[model samples]
Structures are given as C-alpha cells and as structure tokens.
Target: MLAAMAATEQQNRTWSQIDVPDQSGRVVVITGANTGIGYHTAAVLAYSGAHVVLAVRNLEKGNEALSRIVAAAGHGAREVHVTLQALDLTSLDSVRAAADALRNAYSGIDLLINNAGVMLTPKQVTADGFELQFGTNHLGHFALTGLLLDRLLPVRGSRVVTVSSLGHRMRAGIHFDDLQWERRYDRAAAYGQSKLANLLFTYELQRRLAAADASTIAAAAHPGGSNTELMRNLPAIVRPVATLLGPVLFQSAAMGALPTLRAATDPAVEGGQYYGPDGFMEQRGHPKLVRSSAQSHDEDLQRRLWTVSEELTGVRFGV
Candidate 1:
C-alpha cells in the first residue's frame, strides 16, 4: 500500500494503481489479455493511464476485452489507450510476426508481461509439434521475450514479467529425457513443467541481463488459485471437488492479478524476484514477495533450458 515496501509488505495490503506511481507515458504489452487475470491486469494498467496492448490469439475476444477495459478505465476517466495485437504463442511464425509489429511500432517498451498460458490439458502439441502446454506456456513466450529484448534493454526500469504457477512445485521438473512428453503424457505433470519453465526462464534472463549491464530486468509472479478459464481443462473427476471448494479457496481474478501487478509496477522489485498471494499456501490474498521451489533456482537446469529453448525456437536473446 505504500511506495516504499519492506522485504514483504503488510500481509493484507494490496497495490492498486492508486498507490503505484503514474504510468501515463509507459507502454505495457500483455499476452493473453482476453480474459481472466490478463484482462484484469490490462484493465488496471489502463486505469493507470498506460498505453496497454492486449496481445491475444483471437481478435474478436480481444476487442470485447478492450471494451471492458475501456469501461474499467472509465471509472478513473483517464485518457487511456488500449489496443490489441494478434499473437498465437503456439506458432513461432506468429511470435515473430507479433514481435516485428511491436518493434516497428514502439521505439522502447516499458513492460512486457508474459501472462497468457494453458493449464491442464489432454495430450496435444503445438503447430511446432512441441507439447501444447510447454510450447504455448513456455517456449512461445521464451521466443517472444528474446525477440523483444532489444526493445527493452535500453529503457531504464523496463521489466519482463513472466507468470508461473503454484502447481510448478508439484511433481514438476524439466524432463529433458522426454521434454515434449512424446513417450508418456500426464496432463498435470506437463502443466507443471511448463509453469516451472516460466520461472527458470525469468531467472536465467535476469542473469544474462545483469551480466550485460542492461537496463531491463526479469521477474516472475503466480496468481495462486484464481477463478479463471485456465481450469476449464481440469479432469471430470476433479471438477466437482474444485467446484465445491472454488468459492472457499479461490480468489477473484482481479485479486489474483495483484502479484503480477506488484511485480510489474513495484519500484522495489529486482531481477529474479517472485510475487504471489500472501494467504495460506499462496492460494488467495493480496500479493507479497514469495518463494519459489528449490528446483526453480537450479542454475544448471536454467542454463540448459535456455539453450534448448533457443535451439527449439531459433530465437536468440543477445543480452
């Protein structure tokens, strides 16, 4: 709630743009902004007077979200600019096209939030033939961020915010042996690996940026248990229990977006920092600096994943 934050700010306090410094001239690009946490993140940043770009795979849904965000921004009645960019993270061609369009348009970018992702899903692969969850959630974002790093490196205080998940800690590790689940596929584990990749990417990118003495930084955040479309792919057996506990355990998407907003906008945030809900088990509450799993901090795995990502996507970040 205050501009100056302690190691972990007040357990219950949340940061709305009301407490954040003005974002009038900033350019914020957010992926998966059509619904859920991404939509809320765009709305709040629009309310803060930033030029918010809602990057979505579906332009129609993006337009609808644009309308809602405009209304939300109207509550503050700030002259805000909210637009959409076509992006399908499942396709590398799409990632390159989107990155090119952004580069041609903006001279510098302030924030690039890799917020879109898929959760549990049946065995599937991307247009590139990688597992659906891993390809879209991790690889797609990996390529986009790398392609856009040049746009951010020169901007002071610019940040790349990647959203991970609590499920990353549950039976999750980078399965280099079967990276795409070509041999065996478990929906939960596949989702876990993708989420874990998000953190690994964030930390590794931050390291590279620091090594190059670049102005940009990388941070990660998790929404905890938020009521969003991500769970639509949950198995039938677990749906009923999740439904029963949803009201008690899940926070609204707006509340869930706080950790991301904090990580993206907080003045105190540093490279490789993580933010998440402050409630029990990080399920729901206002956000605060949070700890990730030990595996997420493994340097060797981080470097390996980065190398493999570059090889797979063919997009290199010369940090």
Candidate 2:
C-alpha cells in the first residue's frame, strides 16, 4: 500500500485567479461541457487558449455554451479555443462515434476530461441495457477513454482527468455483485458506485499506463458542493435545504471548477492523485490535493472492473 503520489502540494486558487499559461497548441475534450461544472471547466480552459472539444449529448446546449464562451472571450482580447460535438454517454455507439470524430479531427489530445455524469435519480437503463447512473457516469467514459487512448498516448505528457464527487465517501465503494442494482435500486448507492468507479478507473488506468511504459497521467477531481445542474434530479424537498446551506457551505460553479482546472493545467500534479475543496468537510472552497476512500484503491476490484468494462464495450485501452 505505497503512496501513488509524492508529497502533497495543494493549492488555493479560483478560476479567474488562475495564471493562464500558453495552451494554444493543445487540444482538450471534456464531457458534459454544455452546463454546470463542466461548462465552467470547458469555458475556463478554452478561454485560456486550449482548443476545447465539448463532448455533449445535446447539440443545442453545446452550441449555446460555445456561443457564450466565444462571446465572453471576445471582451478580454483573448481568443478562446472552443468547439461542439455530439456525445451521448448512454450509448456505446455514441461514445465511439465521438472518439472517432475526435481522432479523425485532431492529431493529438492534450487532455481528456471525463466530466459528464448523473446524480441520484430514478433508475433507468441506457441504450445498452445497463443502469443509467453506472452506464453514463462510469462505463461510458471507460469506453470513450479506451477507444481514444491511442491518440492520447502519442501526445507526451498528456493527462486524463475524471470528475468524481464527495458522495463517493458515502457509499464507501463499488457493489460488484449488484453493481447494476438488480435486487434493490438505491439511487444514492448507484451514484456512489459510479463515483467510486471514477477513482478506481483513474488509479487502474495509471497502473496500466505504467505497465505499458507510457507517461500519460490519469488523475481525479471533485467540485465539492457547487450549484450545478447535477442536482436537477434530486428530490424537490432537497432544494430548500441546499439553498439555505449553499451560501455558507457551497461554492459557485466557477469556484467549484478550480480543482478541475488545476488538475488539468497544473504542472506540479502527479498521476493517480485526487483534488477537491479544502474548506470544512472538504465540501466547498479553493482547490487542494485530497485523499480518496480505501475502496477506491482496491486493486482487485479495479482489475475486475477493467475487464468487465473492456468486455462490455469491446474496446481496449492503449499505452
């Protein structure tokens, strides 16, 4: 159980406060870039000069987000890198189509942000008949990452940043036997499994890259308690409590995106590390390196999940 990362060097920075480094030649693909934390993440990165491909499910939303980013960038004498592409994470075919489109369009990808996800919501199946949260949040990204890993490998120092949540601490880890929640479907548990998978995927991916002698880094980050569209499916009663607690405990979307921005842009980070807010409960504040749950680092489950994911998606990740 050795540490995967070296000494921690957490930071305290906001999106606007971030130092913009030259990213003109780099390309990044972010899922769920049309709204919420994903929107802010993409906008900030694009505004800083990284050509951003927004992999989203809805073209209308993606175009709208692109327009906003473009318009916003016009004011500061900065030309933001931005583009919109269709990606429905609920379907394996859709995931492949998006990856193929990116591979065909770009020579190398500097960053891949597995940012799209679903929260605690009703039980539904994706196009492939898997549970909705698990499918869209974890499996979809797994397939997409595997499919595009070759393109990523060629770009030395490339990184894959997966967005997870503090809810991961709640469920503890994956329920391998009932991962799909066949017997009983607790929405929160399902979401927790998906989030935990994000961490596991990050670590397992790093292990694979090392085994293949690749330098690509895989890291994870969480937004804390940001006001994002992730709460769209929560019970109506949950809003008032959240609203009341938000001002004191939650952060703005821009603030919430800091950790992700840092993980994406910071040169000091290492593979298999995680970042989140540094405030009380690690719920809201500036970006900082943080710890993940014990289950997140379970090697056995990680390998099993990797095999299952490859078999299910028929995609093999490359070095």
Candidate 3:
C-alpha cells in the first residue's frame, strides 16, 4: 500500500523547468508583460521560440521588458520575436482597441495569459465606473477574451489562462448587489472578490468551450506570494511588514511565474484546472495543480457571474 501511494504521488507531481516544451510557431499574448511574473513568463516563452506579444498599459515599460528578454535570450534571441502592444484593462474602450489590434496583426493566438492585476488598492472606480479591482481584473479580461474568441477558436490547442490569487480564499464572494462597492469597501475584500471572479470566469469559460466542442480551453493560475509590483497597492502598514519579510517569506518573480507558464503550456493540463506553488500554503515552490475553495466550483455562481460579466463588458463569447 505504501508503494502504491508513493506511485500515485509521483504520477500527480509538480511541473519543473525541464517540463516546458519548445513553443515554436506559437503566438502568445500576455497582459501586463512589462514586469514581475508577466515579464518572466514572457521571457521564458520567447526563449523557447514563441512569438510573444507583451500586452501592457505602458509602451515604454513594455519595450524595456522586451529589450531585457532579448538580452537574456543571448544567441537564442535571434529566433525569439517579442513585440509590445498597449492594453489598458481599466477601460473597456482600450480593451476593445487592443483586441482589435491583435486580431489585425495575428491570425491566431495559441495562448492568452491574463496576468495583470491590482491588489488591495484604495476604493476607486474604473473608467467604466465599476470597482477598480473587479473592473480590471475580471471584467477587462472577460471583454478581451470575448473579443478575441474568434482568433482563439479556430486555432487548435488554444488556451485562455487567467491569473488569480491566494487572496481569493479570504472573505471572497461576488457582491451582486454592490458589485461596484459603492457603499462600504474594504481593500482586501475587494481584491479577494476580483481574484475569485478570475476563477469563476475560467471555469465558466471552459464549460462553454467544451459545450461548443471547441479545441480551445480555459485555465487559471496563481503566483503564490512572490515579490512583485502587484503588492504596491497594499495598505501602508502592510507594505513595510511585507518588505521586512520579503527575503525569507517570498519567492522570486521567476519562480512565481511557473504556475502560469505551466497552465499556458503544459500539454497534459486540462481545462478548468488551477495551478499554484507546491510549497506550504502554496506560498513558494515549483508549479503544481492546486485546488481552489469550494465556492470557486459552484456552477450556479459561475453562470451568474458570467451573465453579469457579459452585461458589464458588452462583449459576448462565441462559446
């Protein structure tokens, strides 16, 4: 029995650096690819010979990231094609425009990584007048994915990988009545809701894709407490504590990106799967398949969220 258990554990194991396959001929679009986990993901994919489009809000930062990725690629850089495209997730118009630009430039996208997000920010509304976190983290990606559905559907093995967070476990639920949080707002709770929405979106998208019999899939991942810019929005008090604990408690950005890369590229990965770190509490380690909260798997909630997201974004998926 012990031997059998050990075998099972080995079969259901975490993915490592050697597990990543060559990505030649693949076109990957990663949002917020200018920094942190996004940048690391883009760098690795580019090095593996994929055409990586860094969909970022800031063109200068995106170009800078591209340059750094190229420099890191060394002689392999010749085969890597990294381009920058402006994408501001806070605005519906910007999301639509960016999707349109991508559709015009690329015939198909093999991977779409929704990796950009804000964390624990003070109460604010997006240009669309929705809560900042929900609007950008969930609604924005929903719109972009819907707009790019045409490009993704026709391509074999296409995928949409949304990045959620461990924070999703904390007091997180869809606030349908106050989706915008116009009444009472707690920064942490708002961030949690947005992350939970990411998972809900991913699961619903996968269901729709399967129903449509499309070759594409949807998946979700989390960075698992890495030292990244996403923490810049944390409360002032928490920021200093995080800084002091950074070295010992947090993993590097590159390590944090593994789960996302695995979700996007792993051949054995199934639709609706969530990836995170293999370490204690999923804080830091190599990438592995991880279980989300019970709420994340609620089908009724997923459908409701999907409908509301469609209404807000004004973009409907073909799936």
Give the whole-model CA lDDT for all candidates, comma-separated: 0.92, 0.86, 0.92
Off by over 4 Å in 3: 1-14, 76-78
Query: In angstroms, how far off is 123's CA in candidate 1?
Result: 1.0
TM-score of each: 0.96, 0.94, 0.95
Q: List ranges where model 2 is wrong by over 4 Å.
A: 1-17
Let me know the TM-score candidate 2 reaches against the reference structure: 0.94
List ranges where model 1 is wrong by over 4 Å: 1-17
Candidate 1 to truth, TM? 0.96
Ranking by TM-score: 1, 3, 2
lDDT of 3 by residue, 190-293 (tens): 99999999999999999999999999999999999898988778778777888898876799999999999999988878899999999889999998889999
Q: List the residue pairs that clash in candidate 3.
A: none
| Pairwise lDDT winner, candidates 2 and 3 | 3
lDDT of 1 by residue, 3-56 (tens): 445534543466554665678899999999999999999888888879999999
Q: Where is model 1 poorest over a 10-residue stretch in terms of lDDT?
A: 3-12
- The 10 consecutive residues of candidate 2 with the worst lDDT sum are 1-10
Which residue pairs in candidate 2 have backbone atoms (N, alpha carbon, C) closer than 3 angstroms, thus clashing? none
